[model samples]
Target: MPNIQFFALAESVCKKLNLPPIPFPVRKGRDEIIFNPQGVALDLLLDELEQYLIEKPEEKIFYKDAFSRLAAIEGIRLGEEGFHDHAAHYFELGLALDPANLALRSNYALSLQSAGRKEEAMRQYRFLLQQPVISGQCLVLIPAARLFLDCGDPVTAHQIVKHCASFMPVDNEFWDLFAEARQRCGIKRWMAPRQKQQEIMRQATAPDYKSAPTGKKKNFCPACGNRLKPGARFCGGCGHAL
Candidate 1:
């Protein structure tokens, strides 16, 4: 999809990088803007767009836009380099300029989490949850829930997942997290009260044969749901560890 926000971001990035702007056909009526992605790849375009913005004497509105884009780009790069505090600084500046930028907000929240600023990250995630445009997005919802869980607020995480259930797909990872949240939050009502009581009675009365003793419970990778081998530190499928 051609995201208008990202299109403007690309233009702003080009300005900050002092690179020639992508050519667009000039429209006479209603200023219709068209973009073609056949020639240059988006990643390559963004790679060329990375730079720090320097203010000039005769700065215009475009300069501020470029500054915000540059800040966002640099913030992401710095965050990847493990300089999360510095990344957050740039993300804050970018968000101050364009408060409605969802991508920048997401990056800001991630930077805060990476910097061990848990409360700040949660605050940003709450703000994002209130935004209609971002609330239903998986990118925002998944991380927000994970952050809530990390903050020892599994109830909030479960609530977030419940609110987004209709729109979000039922993924194994989400279900795994939901199960953990429910367990941690002490939510035992998985069925009707009468049915739960009946099931409990059935289990109590059922004759059980002791099976062979099982060893330690198996662990699965949270990212990919692959069965973790004994003593393995990382997931074989996705490379993420528990």
Candidate 2:
């Protein structure tokens, strides 16, 4: 299974945040497997390549260039469209090329979580959070905390957000998760100032933030009118694709 390969490669390197095995493991006689560049446009690939190289300069010398990152993007797009298995396949293909790609690994975990493979998803999250790099990265940490909440372990989530909250910008995306974590820990007596601060942060950062009348939701859900979380790709209330 790719899961075993993923974890094995991760363990071999002692779980560094960015370094997976250089020239990732492949089946015998397939070391020469060339990545075919198709599906995504070349211009888009090049554009993303420039951004990726800037963000992850360590990957500049890797084989196949930006194709692996492209594959990761495609995988995420597929997952958002409800084709999860296909998404996993794309992520696996991307990881095979660039095993160190954090985006590929984290999105793979998310796809697994969306498919109801929570344990497998947590395995990936555990590997990710072990690295200090992930602690300050809102993209990975928030989702991992959300997964912890979904698994009914808000205490862990609260701990994660608590540490991150100290250093992360107050106006950023961590507050909602922080609030949810606090609520889950049965901390009902929130200070008014903190509540006001959370609301201010939400208004400042939320893409869909809006005020609505009584009996109406600020965010719409087809299956249920649960207020959507910022940056959520799916509805939390009914598991509906957003």
Candidate 3:
């Protein structure tokens, strides 16, 4: 109904994995295929594909797109099942085959974050931000801002959202994070019209700001904004180890 190509592929995968074929019932209309989410054993198929990829790494370049799709699906399934580390592993494998796949990259970064691998998550987000297509996507911007805020970089979070504002209307989530960033950066939102107007005027008339004095910079957790105790190897707030 809805393109039975993957169905055949799934059957082949089952054979390769030495598993029984999925008994997909024959349906009358295309709508049945569209509505049935569990019509296939996607997770099992993906597991088989992962094993196949592992044993036949040379075939990855030839079957990159298929492998990437399977990996993405499996990663999402594992993440939904509360297996974040496994999810991250699959996502990483997917990204390795198709580095330009932003969706896979986003999912992988999210999995890394969920798995308490904050530094690695930040690195992936930063890499995504540098990509022209990804930099403009709100999906990437929102999470990157959140990560930056959590990592004690509200200034960076604010800057990222502010840049996004020029291209797209800010959503509620963006505004919420923006408010948090402002608060954390020692700024307050004005409720009064007069105060708001005065603040705007001040900003318009203020002289150019000078750089702060150079000193030893404080270290903060990449996972949470808690100040890192000297020589500490983990985040106290989120339990993310360095």
TM-score of each: 0.53, 0.49, 0.58
Task: Estimate the TM-score for candidate 1.
Answer: 0.53
TM-score result, candidate 2: 0.49
lDDT tens readout by residue for model 2, 1-242: 23211112235332432333333323332222321233223223333444445566666666353457557666877898998877887777677667777778888888888788889889888888877777777767777888898799999898887777777546535677787789989987443346788899988887865566577346767688887887788998888998
- Candidate 1 achieves a global lDDT of 0.68
- lDDT of model 3 at residue 96? 83
Pairwise lDDT winner, candidates 1 and 3: 3
Colliding residue pairs in candidate 1: none
Estimate, for each residue in 198-237, the C-alpha lDDT of model 3 and write its tens digit: 8899999999889878999999998778998999988888
User: Candidate 2, clashing residue pairs?
Assistant: none
Query: TM-score order of candidates, best first?
Result: 3, 1, 2
Which one is best on lDDT? Answer: 3
- Against the unseen true structure, what C-alpha lDDT does each candidate score? 0.68, 0.66, 0.73
- Maximum-TM-score candidate: 3
**lDDT ranking, high to low:** 3, 1, 2
